[model samples]
Target: MSEEKNEITLKNYQVKIQDGLLQHLAEFIKPLWQPKKIAVITDDNVGPLYVDKVEAQLIEMGHRVVILTVPAGETSKSWEQVQVLIDSLAQNNFVRSDGIVALGGGVVGDLAGFVASIYMRGISLIQIPTSLLAQVDSSVGGKTAIDLNAGKNMVGSFYQPNLVLIDPSTIQTLPKRMLVEGYGEIVKCAALVGGSFWEIVQKVHQPADIILQAESLIHASIAFKASVVMRDEKENGLRKLLNFGHTLGHALELIEDGQLMHGEAVAVGMAYITAAFEKKGMTAAGTTAEITARLAQVGLPLVANQLGSAAFYRAMLHDKKIKGDQIILVYIKKIGEPAFYPLKITELKKWFEPILNSQIEDN
Candidate 1:
């Protein structure tokens, strides 16, 4: 991809999403023919579900396909799994010019993408997002990583894909909880680009059409992300804005020991952070109620609990976003307006005390 006059002809890859996207993988991916071999990395869950269909089409198109399946879910996105994939690629004589297609949700995309990045120094990555969250969020940005014992995404890279294939119909296979889990990313965009768009999230009849009418909302979230990524592909800058709900979110997950999904904790974290955003007058009146209703509609959380407050704060302090004990929290003033909040490390222990008080009810 070359940047000519601030216009980068996104040659690296393409985002071709239409109805019935999965079966048409061969058709939509014509530009991806440069690779000598194609490795489709998926997980145990998504492979049996969609692989045969996609592979049949790829074979018909005369492409040599390599299939690599990792255990499904977050735990699979680790150094060990990545090592297995890398070893497989090596055994298969994979080359730098070869491209890897990531199939599944964010976990698959991240794990495979990191492999694509580190293997042979750098390799091309193609994204086929089977989940709504991956389609709209994770798959687009080059940000790819795995969790560390220290914190989430503590080990990763900014490896963009050569192409992003989105099949909205895939959502049909997504469990209700998975479908609902995606809304938190949507809501993160909602809170980041606060305005009447948040109202649409509150009032839209068809959730499917919300992003269409509100493309800017998605773009806003990405813009916020791009600002961070553009400056720090390594996550060294404005990218912290994307962690709006992740402070308490990561901790809640740690406490649950990954019993809940990433977005689940984020949902709870968003609800918890609302107290701080509200206290600061960043959140509009009544908006909290509206988000609560919306979250419930999609099956997200609207509060955090006291049981894991200590561990959650501990995780936050050790978080990758922390800088010398100063926790930088992303706070929303309204929909579409997000700002950074740098809190002292010493105050973090005291910070959650008032925020987690029973005064603020959880949904």
Candidate 2:
């Protein structure tokens, strides 16, 4: 098949998505930034699979490249890892003119992006997101962050990248579970934007099919995210809608520790929150059933009971979305229509009783 090149222009930069983009890394990098050094931050999981090829490509173009690999998974997204990266950069003398490349999944993107944002106040960043989750969602927006002991993405910045390069071909080697986690983000994006994309998601099943059709889905998601980020780059308004299932989803992820993947938790969050939104007349009457059924069909979780409702609620109190006593929440009116609702944090437990009650029973 022919290659697909899709562009998303933001206020400060652009996201370029295409097949076979990785092979031409030098061509893409030269215009974005010409530097004495390039720090490629990736993970052990991804580094072994794809880093050598990427490193060779950069070196062939006569660019000096530094490769740094962290352990794979969420645990790597921490202050400790950030310090390790900073020390390495300092020792290697990464200056303002130099650029950092995020060459892994969301964990690497967020960690490296945060490193780019804070090192010497700020530096140019090029995101080469490999996993499906990072390609469709995290890589495009400049929402760089590292999780704290208290919450996910609690300490970070709204630092946008100089360029985002996505190659859907990288996902061919991803584990089945990781790809399903990516589908969660894809479904979340479709629910938010709703149209032909939503229709496409409803019919997709099997991993091989998703990989075959990855480019289109990822391109559509980046386009939607880029539009929102361009309008509200700092997430003051329209950007908040992107948190549709994330509020509760984040809480569950923290509580479950490593058991629940981000997408799986959010799938449960979407299902649970949609039910609550329906009960409150905030969402379409059948929104919950429709959303949950589709997610279930795709094998994402509809309930999280590993830590029970009370613990989940307690964890949510520490979420970044909680502003003092009030928490900012995104609610769905239906597919393609989402709105923000601020509620007192103390009232969250009572307001989401039905969803929480179900989790209580499951626990």
Candidate 3:
């Protein structure tokens, strides 16, 4: 079959998804932002595998390339790392015309994209997302951010990339856990986009198999995201639906302190929140059980009692989604659709206690 290509046109630019597109980096970027200089920011784990290949290709095409690598994992998304990256960019004599290429997972994509958004006020950003999570979600939206000690993505901006290149073949290099983490996001997308996509997801139980079967799923997920983002680029409206499991997910991640990957945390959030919503009569009957089973089949944690419900609730108060007295919560109406429900901060513990306490029953 021919390579899959998708173009998502926003008011400013487009997102392109194609298999093995990274090999043609030169040609792919030539039409977007033909830069004299490019800063390829990646993490240590990914740098050894793909960054050099990208650098060599860019050099062969006669463009100046600078490769910068930070320690891998979620910690790299801190404000301190962002400062270090900025200082490095300045020290390298990078100018406004130079572009940034985010070549890792969501962490690198968020950090590098945030850097590009602020450097010289703004510059071109080309996302060559390697990880499945980055490829399917973070890389497409242009919502760049760094974490503060207070919360995940405490600081962020809605900066769109000039172009996004999704190369599904790159996912083959990911670790099993990483792939499973990506599956968490994929499950989120499938649950939100229901229809043929959900049907396709129902058959697979392993993350490794997704690479072999990702062609249509990746395209569909990105297409769905693009449509939502195009309608609400700043996330002031419809885009919030995409946060289905993210509210409590972010809280669990913060409470766990790097033990939980983004996808894993979101998986728990999906299950617990679905249960909570069902209990409140907000979601359809059995929605919780359906989501919990899907998440459990993928080996995701379904309970958050590891940190205790009180602490989890405390951590949640730090989420940026909180608005004064009420926080915006995203809940699934069914497998393919989602709706937002804002809840008072004071009532969070009452709602979250049973789900967090489920861990005791599970044990």
Best by TM-score: 2
Model 1, residue 213: what's the lDDT?
37
Q: Which residue pairs come into collision in candidate 3? A: 194-336
How accurate locally, in lDDT, is each candidate?
A: 0.72, 0.84, 0.81
Model 2: ten consecutive residues of lowest lDDT: 354-363
Model 2 agreement with the true structure over 1-363: per-residue lDDT tens digits: 112357777777778888898888877777766546889999999999888998888777677899999999898989899999999999998888888889999999999999999999998888999999999878977889998788788889989898889888989888888888898888888999888989878777666768877878898888888778778887778988888889889889998987899988888888888888888788887777777766776677787675346788898888666677899989879999888889998788789885556531110
Question: What does candidate 1's lDDT look like per residue over 237-327, in tens digits?
Answer: 6667778788878777766787777777788777767676676576776545555566766557666554335666666666777787588
Error of 3 at 336 (Å): 2.0
Q: Which stretches in model 3 have alpha-carbon errors above 4 Å?
A: 1-5, 358-363
Question: How much lDDT does candidate 3 score?
Answer: 0.81
- State candidate 1's TM-score: 0.87
**Could you tell me the TM-score of candidate 2?**
0.94
Pick out the ten consecutive residues of candidate 3 with the lowest summed lDDT: 354-363
User: Regarding lDDT, does 1 or 2 come out ahead?
Assistant: 2
Better of 2 and 3 by lDDT: 2
Candidate number of the best lDDT: 2
Using TM-score as the measure, name the better of candidate 1 and candidate 3. Answer: 3
lDDT of 3 by residue, 1-363 (tens): 112356656556666777778888777777666648888999999899888789998888777888889999878988788889889889988889888888999999999999899988887888888888898889877799888888888887889898888888888888878877887888898899889988877777665567777776678788888788878888788988888899888888988878898989999888878877777787898777777666777677776555455678788888767788999999988788788889999888777776555542121
Q: What is the lDDT of candidate 1?
A: 0.72
- Arranged by lDDT, best first: 2, 3, 1
